[model samples]
Target: MQNRQNQIEPEWTIIKILQWTTSYFKTNGIDSPRSTAEILLAHTLGFKRIDLYLRHDQPLNVGERNLFKSLIRRRISKEPVAYIVGSKEFWSLELVVSKDVLIPRPETECLVEEALLVLDKDKVSAPKRILELGTGSGAIILAMATQNPDQQYFASDISINALAVALNNARHLGLDEKIDLFCGSWVSPLKENNNLFDIIISNPPYIRRGDIKTLQPEINRFEPINALDGGEDGLACIKHIIKNAHKFLNKSGTLLLEIGYDQKKAVDEIIKETGRYAQASFRKDYSGFDRVVCAKKAYD
Candidate 1:
């Protein structure tokens, strides 16, 4: 019998490659191996899932076969599919992603949902001012402005590279006119101006430094550490925003934040210490973990 491991050209077909890749992924501890294989193959072919079905029996051209082999090698090395594809979907919007930005997580969608609820209750009208700190890929702000066309949005990020990615997404989504993009740390660009926002939202760095090493290889190896490391306790950025957000928030304005699952107590304490916010509370993610914290500026 031919040795499968030693053979250079294993005479694999497209359908066979899919089966092999799926099994390889499963053996490597990847969850949803079959779905991952389908998505990755579709992405490699520049086709949709249904299209894959249509061409399941089609033979891959030599160039296509080489490309699939390269991608499979990378996948075996534990690279994230989003990074390989150079884009990710968040809040139903396709956003460009790179090593400069953290891939937007589904959990962060909770921040968007909570922000919309606050806007609804506050009755915010047209030309509403909204600020998003650390707007990586502009996912959150773009999603918000797309949903609420009447709102005027502002976004800032500490990394210039991340800002570039975000600006591209905003332009691609036809939201450039609705958002003012800034390049700087959290709340820094807003400090020089007296502009207060009706709503402020952020999904800042909230992962502890030590814990980052323990994360999955796809995250630790590929994602920008600066965007994930939240200092020793994972509350560095959270505390900074909580301390500074009140200054940029309109009276009675709301602040929405995405927090680490174990960070509810620390974040709640920060809000309480600020003495500038009331009705501080947290909402759980779809996983039923406390993931979002919402607070409002104290009514004077």
Candidate 2:
């Protein structure tokens, strides 16, 4: 067999393969090369990431090497690692994902954190009704349900295919029964429903439509366009949610939204313009960027 250096090799061992793949990924400008190499190799060998180091001396058979090679090729083309592996760990839960939905992001955990804070404060009363819009992969709702199981959970998505992925993830996480899934844009499906939520949350598409192509290739090329396009100013979804959420929120209900890093001012303005929410505020992500916005419905 040909080795990484293109010379003949009797066998390709785990350590050698990892070293080769890491160098190759680096040369190709792939991020986190060593970690990517380990993830792909571990997946191919049916081992955990740490297991790869433990079995460093183990030899990869032809079949295993071929599978690893295929994954590497896909990665080199900029397909997301989550899509390649078919799952992503968000809030410590492995969620199913696809091109139909935006991959669950770590920054979105800020939204979950804010949501949990709201839920915690309301726990002394009866179970609070909670709703999440654009619930891709059910990440936010599921994470909240996992932590605060006493609340009533509901989630909606515009894309049926995206909802399917979220539903499957919910089932996998055993949260299917906990969250009621709906298919429609924003709060459309809930317009006729009598239930008013104590908390409404979302991590909507906020990328400017024209700026979608400017994002990283893994996002611009591979992820769903509908899940990324945020119209001319990247606030279409945000505006819609802010304007319509009042109809579904109980008096003084909280709205928590994950926003673009630079959107604090604009979103703050939108919330103020509607005169529906007061004390519009923001929470920063680990990177110190304003990643989540919080506001409460203005009581009449």
User: TM-score winner among the candidates?
Assistant: 2
Give the Cα-based TM-score of candidate 2 against the true structure. Answer: 0.95
Model 2: pairs clashing at backbone N, Cα or C within 3 Å = none
User: What value of lDDT does candidate 2 attain over all alpha carbons?
Assistant: 0.90
- Against the reference, the lDDT scores of all candidates come to 0.87, 0.90
- Cα lDDT tens digits for candidate 1, 30-79: 86888888888888789887887787776666677788778877878888
Candidate 1 regions exceeding 4 Å error are 1-13, 124-126
Separate clash counts for every candidate: 0, 0
RMSD of 2: 2.5
Worst 10-residue lDDT window, candidate 1: 1-10
Best by lDDT: 2
